[model samples]
Target: MANHDTETTEKLEKFGKRLKELRKAKGYENYEQFAFKNNISRSQYGRYEKGQDIRFSSICKVLKALDVTFEEFFKGFD
Candidate 1:
């Protein structure tokens, strides 16, 4: 159980890193600006970037806002 928890934490952190990477690539240096522009909850998006859990539908919205397909967003993740 401990190992599983660790693995989950690692995955979440990686996901957050990927999100930040994409956001920066899209020319938004500030997460707040990105969230505000996309009509997402800025605090929630900040939590997401800090590796907090997120809902599937919310992630889909984020992906759409980032102009990335599911496949593209998950490309390098395992």
Candidate 2:
């Protein structure tokens, strides 16, 4: 059970990092540019990608900004 939880947490961290990288790879320069491109506030979006526990409402908004469904973000997880 602990192992499963650890794996899920690790996967979330990886996803968060991947999102940050994608912003860079997409040539957005920084969070400010990325958020601006997606019409989100930079500081707030930073909190979204920080991989910390956040409200579902904020999560949904962030997912919308990322242009991904929950299934897409969570992929192989059940």
Candidate 3:
């Protein structure tokens, strides 16, 4: 059970880092700018970037705003 939890946490962290990288790649240095531009809540998006729990719908929204397909987002996934 503990191992499963740890694995989930690690995956979240990796996803968050990748998300941040994608945002930066899209020319968003400030998270606030990204959130505002993408119509996401700044604080909530911040939590997502910090590897906090987020809804799948929210993830989809973010990905859509980034112009990334689900396949592209999960590319190189473990």
lDDT of 1 by residue, 1-78 (tens): 133487898988898899999999999999999999999999999988887898899999999999999999899788
Ranking by lDDT: 1, 3, 2
> Tens digit of lDDT per residue, candidate 3, span 1-78?
133488899888888898999999999997889999889999989988877787999999999999999899999989
Worst 10 residues of 1 by lDDT: 1-10
- RMSD in Å for all candidates: 2.7, 4.6, 2.8
Compare the candidates by TM-score and give the number of the best one. 1
Instruction: Enumerate residue pairs that collide in model 1.
Output: none
| Ranking of models by TM-score | 1, 3, 2
Better of 1 and 3 by lDDT: 1
> What are the runs in model 1 whose C-alpha is more than 4 Å off?
1-4
Best candidate (score: lDDT): 1
Error of 1 at 58 (Å): 0.7
Better of 2 and 3 by TM-score: 3
